[model samples]
Target: MKEEVTQNYLEKVKAQIAKLQSFSIVRIPREENIEADYLSKLAIVKEGIIPPNAPIRYLELPSIFALDVQVQAIDYSNSWTGPIVDYITNGTLPDDNVKARQLKI
Candidate 1:
């Protein structure tokens, strides 16, 4: 399940990357970044010292891309959701316009 969640998040990241006109991802050496040293020290401090003004957010769902595992259960064992799931998750659909339109929903 953890792997599934990670993969789902990765797919979302890839989708966002697809929309970029241009971008670059790089790594900075910790030795050259003093902020990294300070942040590491801060992690050793006691927990829950957050200010009341600091907005505390909680996740009700494991992730925004939570899997709909029961989508295949809609028809009582018949696998009608395969097409829709494929369409939504992978952007894959039939070439026919009508079929693609139906899957878009």
Candidate 2:
């Protein structure tokens, strides 16, 4: 029974690690990991029912896109695109007839 429980725990851990394709696992000793010990003591308090399709949201660092920034600069010009930009940014209709028609299309 004990061996079966250990095998089940190991399988669950393996499945979780498999989801993270590019990750480095660091084994920290209990004596050196004070934060882990402290965090384990904090009990989870559920206030409301979680949705059936609730996503397992995980923290991810924002990706740097130098090419996308450069493309945006090349694609749009403030001089001619101010009205369209205003409409997009503030959800307001452009005063100019030509720009307004273009936006609608």
Candidate 2 ranges beyond 4 A from true positions:
35-105
Query: How close is every model to the real structure, measured as TM-score?
Result: 0.34, 0.28
Question: Top model by lDDT, which number?
Answer: 1
Off by over 4 Å in 1: 26-56, 66-105
Estimate the TM-score for candidate 1.
Answer: 0.34
By TM-score, the best candidate is: 1
The true-versus-predicted C-alpha distance at residue 103 of model 2, in Å, is 23
**lDDT of each residue in 1-105, candidate 1, tens digit only:** 889888888888787689799879988887897666556655675685543333445678866546634334244224677667777778888778998888776
The residue pairs that clash in candidate 2, if any, are: none
Worst ten in a row by lDDT for model 1: 68-77
Q: lDDT value for candidate 1?
A: 0.69
